[model samples]
Target: MGSGHDTRVAVVVVTWNSAGVIEGLLRSVQGSRLDGSVRLIVVDNASSDSTVQVVRELMPDAEVLQAGRNAGYAAGMNAGMAAAGDCDSYLLLNPDIRLGPTTIQSMLEELRESGAGIVVPRLVDEFGALRLSLRREPTVLRAWGEALLGGRRAGRFPPLGEVETRAEAYDRRTEADWATGAAMLISRECLARVGAWDETYFLYSEETDFALRARDAGFALRYTPEAVAVHHEGESHESPALFSLLSRNRVKLFRSRHGAARTALFWSGVFLGELIRAARPTRRAAAWALLGNVRGVARPSS
Candidate 1:
């Protein structure tokens, strides 16, 4: 139902205790000469810091929404999107991400050209390192591959510019299985058809679920090297208990959707992977966050 090019846009950023990085993110965004039609939406997930205040002061024009408490990522995003109403497209962003000036403009162009449901830009770090924002669906095989072979290793490679990397067309966006939620451009039609993020997931795996559902609904997830953003990947896998909790949550999602057979396979792989890899310093926090995911989906905790 959209015409050729839609200058009207809404950018949704979800934050949680990300004050340190968010300041830079907002600053970078404010500096960008994104189309004048672009509207910025910052949803603070009840950060205890001055994140909310800083955002209000720095980007006063940016539509600010507070979750009242530390709500999960999905819920926060949904609230922002609802407030944004219908736009030609929506840019889903993270608080720590740094967006290129033309990123939003370029993504909008691609949306018109490709007609895909979603478009995600190239992700890089402050050091200018590449991050594979495109990826295969989080299946038991993919999860094990991550736990065993390391998932984000693709970041070490060059940008996957309009090319196929892994197995035939795997996450290539010509036919991608999923795109990272960091800074994605989604179509209004798809948003109406598929609706907003599922409230089930607390933090992780929600993007995967959304992508899979979109695919099922006859929409393709795309990756464009043209549009780019910088995202700081956070790792809190220091505690063994946290690691175990994350392990449990992974099973929780898989089992809930795919059934016991697939979940069993994934757990089997993870159990073996634990022996193969060392734990991180914040593993306990990571594990607890994982448990929180289980609690999240189970109760739809906002």
Candidate 2:
């Protein structure tokens, strides 16, 4: 682990037409209290908006890399990491996140003290409501549990579901199989051992794949509540295309790690869950998308 005062952290932000939302994240990062040096690297995935100009205006010293085209999130992240050069840690952040003044410091301390390879901060919504960011490893049984009992109810029992919805679970630090990717700190060792984020996953499940691989490589994913941040949730909830991509990626990720029979079972559970929720008008699009009925749904560029 790098020394507290000597640690060098690279903050990598990937932007795609995020001019409106990226400012808060950039400003919060500028205001963060870190004993170590910080290198800000912004990778723009061909944002048609003025994201690059905004980044330059807010952080003049930041290193901005133009992706040249609208690459996916994983590809954008990989490009940013490559340009980050040598650093003690990498802070992967979404443009919608607002870090606390001591968020980076707290996560660094947790990473150092606990010897965890990856450190995730506690996340709340814009209204300050706690978001369920923690997740267990994806499995067929958990999928079935979610399909039958629902996520929140099934999550109450660890063996049943993947989402960690228990309030007490976030009150203290704990090890997680994986968590949301909005904001996380990756140690240099972990980065070196696990290598780059998998580019195959255009947007979702990339973090899960990385976290699981880190665990397979003998690294722990630690959650530290002391480091808090606010994340404005993305469009996956409202956009059928994004939601479908999310669901498809979950199955793809599971298939990569499990056998065909198990994958089929997991897919069935996910299909059933979506089917059940399709009764609601608001959820009908996502259900149809899951069944490959995404007629007007365009694939996200970033």
Candidate 3:
């Protein structure tokens, strides 16, 4: 129902203890110039730092919604979407990302041209390294391939893997199974049809679930290198517990889509892969994380 001219985009950013990197993100958002209307919304997940205060001070126009306690990323994003009201598109961004001036404008142009429900931009690091963001849906065989051959090599061969690490199609606009959730512009129609993000995932794999569901609903997920954003990837996985939790969530996501039989096989590949990686002297921490999840190998059925 949206043409290029009369579109409205609501940018939603969910923050959790991100006072260190949020200022740059907010400033970049304020700097983005767009042809269509744009509104900024920040949802703070009860950070002990001054993340909320910084948003209020720097980006006063942005709607700041505070969750009294840490509500996790999916819940915070959902809350932000609820506060966004009516809009033709929703831009979900991580607080550590800084958008290029024309990022939103370019994405809007692509949305109108391609008619894709969800579109993501190219993500680079502070060092200007291209972070491969596109991914293939996880499967038992792909999991084994990734676990054995590594992400980069396995990604190149689709029949054997899920992570799309090849950078060939990054520069040219194309459809992808899913891209990182760091910066994505999603159409209003897709959101209404696909429904809200699965809040059950506390942190990781939420984007994958959303992307898969969107694809299932006949919506396309696209990647455009024209719109670039810098993601200061967080050190969340630096914590062994969080790493274990993330691994657990991956299984849950796989189970939700592929059923128990495939999940069991996927889990086996993951466990073997982690075990092999843990054998190295530098990966002792990973060994502990894997050992801690012995009981968590199988998630409870929903």
For model 2, how does the per-residue alpha-carbon lDDT over 1-302 read when each residue is reduced to its tens digit? 12355789999999999999999998898888878888999999999999999999988999999988988888988888888888889999999999999999999999999999999999999898999999999988999999999999999999999999899999999999999999989999998999999899989999999999999999999999999999997998887778877887887788788766777787778878888888754356656655672321223312
RMSD of candidate 1 to the truth, in angstroms, is 5.5
Residue 116: error of model 1 in Å? 0.8
TM-score comparison, 1 vs 3, better candidate: 3
In terms of lDDT, the poorest run of 10 residues in model 1 is: 155-164
Across residues 1-302, which tens digit of lDDT does each residue of candidate 1 receive?
12233366888899887878888887777666644476789888888888888888888888889888878888988888888875777888888888877777777777888989988887777887776556654466655665555545432222312112343223233547776678878888888888888776677667777877888898888777777788887542444554564466556556556655666665565544554453443444444445354433433222
Residue-level error in angstroms, candidate 2, position 202: 0.4
Sorting all predicted structures by lDDT, with the top scorer first, yields 2, 3, 1
Ranking by TM-score: 2, 3, 1
Q: Pick the candidate with the highest lDDT.
A: 2
> What's each prediction's clash count?
10, 0, 0
- TM value for model 3: 0.93
Model with the higher TM-score, candidate 1 or 2: 2
Off by over 4 Å in 1: 1-6, 34-36, 143-173, 237-246, 279-302
C-alpha RMSD by candidate, in order: 5.5, 4.0, 2.9
lDDT by candidate, in order shown: 0.68, 0.88, 0.83
